[model samples]
Target: MLAAHGFVEAVEQLASGLGVSVLVLSLLLIPVATELPEKVNSLLWARRGKDTLAVGNLSGALVFQGSLLPALGLWLTPWRPSRDVVYAVILTLIATTWLRLANRSGGVRPVWLLVNAACYAAYFYLLTLR
Candidate 1:
């Protein structure tokens, strides 16, 4: 708990130094910290030729986070959709659609993942506009 609190305090200080709100900083950084381990595991599995495990590990985390987090947020919070939330949802849908189309066309090539990265870049750009 102390470590977590210190981590957040550091993030807050960094956000202050960077002249951005802690919310924005957290949005930018926290997901990377949270998701990096799963992504690394998936990459390792893929390199080992465990394609199913690689995909499952990545998709399972996405599925759980996508469904449960929103459900909990809706249940626990007032659930007002801000501009940021709307933009994020729209971007997420766009990325999902892009991935789906890529899957339908053929296997997901490494290059195809660039679209998702572009979506994330778009979100970061959008954040800057606020």
Candidate 2:
């Protein structure tokens, strides 16, 4: 979370300095770049055979992206979410619930990966409509 704040601060500073269409470009890079540290941390854990930590990091990211990030949007911006955004939020809630159940039962089958792909497609479709 602090890393995300630092990432946002760095991007804002760069955008402010550039003073052009810098925000558009910087925002595009921010997500992937901000993930660098987490990726490295996960990779190191995996290399040491600490698989659970690596997996937990990935799962925590999913939860953060789905929940906390959207909450931040509401707090930081005056713009209201569209109906599609509301639907996305509801769908995310359902997905997270399913994830919790899977985690509890150790029932996250390989076939469940297909469901993830479907959800990803649906997310983009909703975004296009928005």
Cα RMSD of all models vs. native, in order, equals 2.9, 6.6
Q: Which parts of model 1 are misplaced by more than 4 Å?
A: 42-56
Tens-digit lDDT track of model 2 for 6-112:
87787778778866334343434665775678888899999999999999997798689657986898789997766655655676677767777776776788776
| lDDT values, one for every candidate | 0.88, 0.71
Clashes of 2: 0
In TM-score terms, which candidate is top?
Answer: 1
lDDT of 1 by residue, 19-120 (tens): 986766877797798789999999999999999999999999988877898699899989887778777889989999999999997689999899999998
Task: Give per-residue lDDT, candidate 1, residue 80.
Answer: 86
TM-score of each: 0.72, 0.52
- The TM-score that candidate 2 achieves is 0.52
